[model samples]
Target: MFLFIGLVLFGADRLLLLLESRGHVNWRRTGRRDLSAEPTARLDSLLEDPDRRPVRRP
Candidate 1:
């Protein structure tokens, strides 16, 4: 009936949103690169150098 049809549509919409949030694709593929290594090096350098100070913005 109408109630069943409404529930089906709602469920479908929720499922689509869940998949999209998890980066699931229906057609195209997409992703981001890992910058973990670069950040670790920069952080180590900053921690080692106690004399250096952060630059102030104008």
Candidate 2:
């Protein structure tokens, strides 16, 4: 029973991570944006490049 419970928890964790990757959830702590800080050079370049706009999902 304990093994089954552990498996279920593991599966749930994986599902949450998958959702986060697909922009359906916000559970991860890595690479979070700091809105108050100045934009980095890499970000600025990406923004200025008209051919590199991020695709929006429907």
Candidate 3:
């Protein structure tokens, strides 16, 4: 029982590592995400009036 549990835990860890390598999971503690424009860009895009249509001045 103990060996099975150990193997399962190790397998899970390796799976997480594999997923991290493929960019499917961000589990590292040292990397900084590219959030430089997230806040401002999110606010700008979200606060715009969705019901209004844009006008193009030709």
Candidate 4:
């Protein structure tokens, strides 16, 4: 009984993928943008000490 249920579920998943490939339906295209490449403020600087600047190596 469990085997037949599992097979049916797997087949349904594959059928959805096939339909999605033909542009009949979109299953994963949500309007989401990756902001990691954008310039972000120095959030770490707030935790650091201004007087603790590292010495330059000569």
Candidate 5:
């Protein structure tokens, strides 16, 4: 039982580190752009709209 618990904890810690590393890599690869344009333009719009449509409930 103790061995099983140790393995699970170790696996979870590794997974978290992997996810965090990927995010950092992605940001580094594409972290530059004027705050007033294209891809992020949608983000700005979302932030501005107070009544954005909600996702349909399944």
Candidate 6:
């Protein structure tokens, strides 16, 4: 049972990879995701900034 499940998962992975190669799906990311480069929320921006005044919006 475990072997069958493993085979199915392996087959599915290969099929997805094939689809990704054909550009039918984005199964894998080409570039490494940079969390630091992502846009920060209002609260996070406020915490990171030196000024925490309500009047100031950056």
Rate residue 30 of model 3 by lDDT: 30
Among all candidates shown, the one with the greatest lDDT: 2
How many Å off is the CA of 16 in candidate 4?
0.4
- Give lDDT tens digits, candidate 5, residues 1-58: 9999999989977776777577743333355756566554466865776567666768
For each candidate in the order shown, give its overall lDDT on alpha carbons: 0.69, 0.81, 0.78, 0.77, 0.67, 0.80
| Candidate 6: stretches off by over 4 Å | 29-58
Report residue 7 deviation for candidate 4 (angstroms).
0.2
My TM-score estimates for the predictions, one after another, are 0.42, 0.48, 0.50, 0.45, 0.40, 0.49
Return whichever of 2 and 6 wins on TM-score: 6
- Poorly placed runs, candidate 3 (over 4 Å): 28-58
Order the candidate numbers by TM-score, best to worst: 3, 6, 2, 4, 1, 5
Top of the candidates by TM-score? 3
Over the stretch 20-46, how does candidate 2's per-residue lDDT look in tens digits?
A: 888887776447668769665676765
- Candidate 6 local lDDT, 1-58, one digit each (tens): 9999999999999999899888788776445558899987888765776555557558
Q: Pick the winner on lDDT between candidates 1 and 5.
A: 1
What 10-residue stretch in candidate 5 is worst by lDDT? 24-33
Query: Model 5: residues >4 Å from true position, as ranges?
Result: 24-58
Give candidate 3's error at residue 57 in angstroms. Answer: 26
Q: How well is each residue in 1-58 modelled by candidate 1, as lDDT tens digits?
A: 9999999989987787778678784422334546674545566875776457776779
The clash number for model 4 is 0
Clashes of 6: 0
Order the candidate numbers by lDDT, best to worst. Answer: 2, 6, 3, 4, 1, 5
Model 1: lDDT of residue 33? 47
